[model samples]
Target chain A: MEVTASIEKERKTNLWGGGTSPLKASYGKIMMWFFLLSDAFTFSGLLITYGFLRYSYPAFSGPVSAFKPSVDYWPIPEKIFDAVPFLHGVHLPLLFVGIMTFILILSSVTMVLAVEAGQRMDRKDVTKWMLWTIVGGLAFLGCQAWEWSHFITGTEEGMALSNGVIIHGANLQVNEYGPPLFASLFFFITGFHGTHVASGVLLNVIIFYNVVVGTYDKRGHYEMVEKVGLYWHFVDLVWVFVFTFFYLI
Target chain B: MEQVVAVEVKPVDKKKVKKLWKIALILGVVTLIEFVMAFTLPRGYLLYAGFIGLTIVKAFYIVSEFMHLKHEAKALIWSIMLPTIFVIWLIVALLAEGGSILNALY
Candidate 1:
């Protein structure tokens, strides 16, 4: 009854208030949503192009695969990202990436907790959970660093082609695992996703500082925390797709 | 200047935290399932289809729960949803055009 009464009073005040927000969400929040939606499309286009190119790669026969992997087939994802971190030379095959995925999702959980705490105006809990979220994001980036280096250094073998051309490791021109095109796509897609994570981390740092300095407290709302949380979660969401399309599939 | 009055904040709910943790568990488990299936499933359409299906499930959970899109206004939700149809169009169009390009090369 009390909540309903407050809401009714708010409606009365809102009706008289000029420049009302859409669906009662502030202009900032709605603008963030719009930015995220456009970003989602950019990622979608890249991923879809990846799918189409990968699907047609084997059958294209445009003098491309003639110089790529032997037997005219796309390199299996498992064969490429099989190296585990710190073990020097071991075949883990999705295990490291699996752990990375877990880390990202766990970070998303912490992000939610931070936002939840902010909603309750619990500054201490918000700071704590936001710290955890930052740690998780950094940990995932560290794993990516290891993974990328491994891909670059390669191992004892590079996938030999039909024309006696052996490409070693990954560069703009070639990769040991498969064709140069595959390597380019791998670097571009994962690199783009990693960039988002990096920016999300940076944003979180700023928000965390604001939370500490009582910016949100002064404003009497933690909506900024929630907005940044949305972006953090979206970064995790994009990684989910990248994991499936780039690593698993 | 307007008078500044302190607002009383409500206590945080324990149930909300529990719900968030539960969703996290589900996401982790689904990802683990994908990892396991990667090794066992024979390389074929079935494996690809299963992975894609599980991926969609994870995406739905993350967007609706963690991102709180589920509780948003219907009009706001529809605005996002309707434009996503273009993503589908993009995929179909690219694959079909790519297939023809490959066929021409063949």
Candidate 2:
């Protein structure tokens, strides 16, 4: 009877603090969720404040003189973000960001698959999927880097700031990509998202190694994937807002 | 019977697995639609509405499907979602206050 009682106690303890359930989620998973929630609030604050700023500003009248395109007010998003790589001078609005969004979303899907595989005790499959997730993440990060550099570097014609600083006029009263606020929000929002993606990639890499070495198998569960999935999906979720607020609105 | 139970392992829930994938596909499609709309639509509140609508839809799908809150007990779902609602409310209030500030500055 004593032996049976001891076994039951061990099982109960294992059930808690060892996997994703009953408020006993593994420390990493719980922390990831908490981090995401806090991050969500921060992004929300930025976006809402953006809405207010845009609202209070003078209605965007056509090109702010000299740099004439058409439309008016904030630079049409299509015109500003339209440049695609390699095919320079060709205007393709939102294509790169659209592609980046797809990559991130796909990575989120792959993360879920890894978690699912872990639950099923398929270590090989989990490893494979996790590796793909990592690749997807890195690709997304690369795309973001390209986007940021493009934003920071001025066009060949040269962009002059109101203060006479010849830099990327992508911000500072703007030639394209909307208002200074638009570029400002774009950097802040996407910068934060990029940071999350980078961290997520690192986290996945660690878990991938753990899987390959049989840590999960030894421990008897794959809740790490689920926790990471929560984070990845949160990142994807945030992008939807960024895309809307920055790109559409 | 006792011997048989000792030898048998708990089965992975296949039905639950199928449901998860189905929901994920739905989310992907919604996101794809949002991307298309973003490209084609004119800039304005209409576009903003579409983007926000799609985002909320995507969020619903993730929380329901990926997070498994849909399958969890009502109390658990509430605990997770209620706080999220409060956050949303706070954002709305802040946005309103910020608008007033902007007006004052203008």
Candidate 3:
């Protein structure tokens, strides 16, 4: 009884005492932030690896019209990502990717709105916003699937390899784009990000269900929504850099 | 018997909701600018720098406003952001090494 009293006194006196959260956040929220920081490092490592490999190859020079896909140099991104869905055969560079970016940003906005609703303990608004966010995520994923298929199917006139092999689309072995490394990195980086989005959508669904079932209403707080919102925003953050490095640069 | 805790649900803050939409509008406008620049600006370091700058701007908004980091404690913000400096160092070191390798190969 004496020890318990002494510890309680220490907790009251000391900010660093074990009883208090010095960071002004719950344990779960702190852990979530650290997890996101580490995940950011992982993504940075991948993107930096891409930068290293990209710089190792000679950049394609001259006009875009004069550019051709070869193992010789890096391919122009505009030429490679020129195709748009449904508008087939027409050259619309970066249009699809722009749409994808907008969808992600819109979803992020909806997620923040859900978090705001969660703060007010407004279950109805939370449900509505989460559903919209989920739809946005699904739409983005569908767009990615179409893009991957388009890339894998190759163009009508595929590029010829140095060894006289005429390859159509892209694989780990060879791609009709430019350097084989380009396709490899594209698949790995974007695939990893897409997997994150897929899981994010799954998480959103779970959270949405919980919201509908009044789980947070029982828990006395909606901190779970805020945690997931952090993750979803991080995904969008990474995509911003990816879009710049992979496409714009 | 189940223990029931009463949670105080405050009225919705119109200012907060308006701020979120305002940020969203900013993001959309910046993205539109990027798209327009992609076609008009000649591909070079200038364009790349602009894109990177804008991307950083967008990331700042997302992290600060959407993630609520701005409202978080200062210690939490520092702990999360300070480590990312290492990533910048890694980028510089690796890119230099890549440049050297390129020169050696050629």
Candidate 4:
């Protein structure tokens, strides 16, 4: 009877995270998780809608065929993003986007290392990893900046009309690169992700500053790294979907 | 049921970290496979299925090992994953609506 009673007490006590939380995270981290969950739903909704639209439309032709300008058909992603930097007129399909994807994935790795160092409270290691994370974030933003500019400038030098609709050279409505909807969805999705990466960069910079000055050390914990780590990983998670939907599918 | 066995895992050591690296390497290989399938294959359910499957594997590793959610309490882990179901639901609903709209327009 005493053993049963003791077991029941232990169970009750252990019900609400009684066993762990070495970092002593606060309510902010939980709220961030909740926020990320909602944001993820929004992105998934957008991408799946893209999927449905692509499928419901008429299918693509062969590699040599130019995409006819219309809302009734979707563009092929690889053929659209084939332009490589400095190798202008070179048709290396999906190479630039592949590089961008790798950069983001590597940033995610650095963020994980930063989180590990935070757990161990190694100030030097934390600083090093956090700086690498920041650099990766900056590099991604730079790539996005270049991509956006290339998208805006386009390949042609004048307005083009397709089916009686006026579209700027390589604008969202139509493009020298691919179909109209391709440019439209490209800007919307990648723009949103770029905003997230930009914010994440700023956040990491702030945290790096704090770490340099021993802010978390003075507070007796380094949960801030854990919080930002969650955010960084969430951004990476979104990119996984974007990379699949935008570049691959 | 005679509940006589409770497995207590020893605290994580260098060996466990090495094991995690192996798992991560496998996940990376799976991601490369996804890339190949996406690029080489035609647009169809096969490509979509492969992409989503590989994506789930990648997420599993990031959450379990990188985020350290696996070592957390069951309640915490479930709480984290529970929200993803709603995301999936949202995707399904939006996809259906988008499909119907495109169908009508086309």
Candidate closest to the true structure, highest lDDT: 3
Please, what are the lDDT tens digits per residue for candidate 1 over residues A28-124? 7778888989999999999998988876666323342233344355677776677786776776777888889999999999999999999888888
Assess the local accuracy of residue A80 in candidate 3 as a C-alpha lDDT between 0 and 100.
92
* B96: Cα error in model 4, Å: 3.0
Off by over 4 Å in 4: A1-25, A61-72, A157-160, A163-168, A172-179, B1-28
Q: Is candidate 1 or candidate 3 better by lDDT?
A: 3
Scoring each candidate complex against the real one, what DockQ results?
A: 0.57, 0.29, 0.69, 0.19
Q: Summarize candidate 2's per-residue lDDT along A1-249 as a digit string, tens digits.
A: 999898777777775444336653456765666676677778777777776666655445544233333212445555577666797877677888888878877787778778878878888778888999999999999999998888867467554445675544465455344456767777777888899889989989999999897777767777877877787778777877777677765
Worst 10 residues of 2 chain A by lDDT: A63-72
Candidate 1: Cα lDDT at A24: 59
Error of 4 at A223 (Å): 1.2
The interface root-mean-square deviations, each candidate in sequence, come to 1.9, 4.3, 1.6, 7.9
Per-model C-alpha RMSD: 5.6, 6.9, 2.8, 8.1
Q: What fraction of the true interface contacts does model 2 reproduce? A: 0.32
- The segments of candidate 2 whose C-alpha lies over 4 angstroms from its true place after superposition are A1-32, A61-73, A158-179, B1-21, B39-41, B101-106
The better-scoring model by TM-score among 3 and 4 is 3
Q: In model 2, state the lDDT of residue A118.
A: 80
Question: How far off is residue A203 in model 3, in Å?
Answer: 0.8
* DockQ score for model 4: 0.19
In candidate 3, which residue ranges exceed 4 Å CA deviation? A1-14, A17-19, B1-9
- Model 4: lDDT equals 0.74
TM-score of each: 0.88, 0.79, 0.93, 0.82
Quantify all predictions' global Cα lDDT against the true fold: 0.85, 0.72, 0.91, 0.74
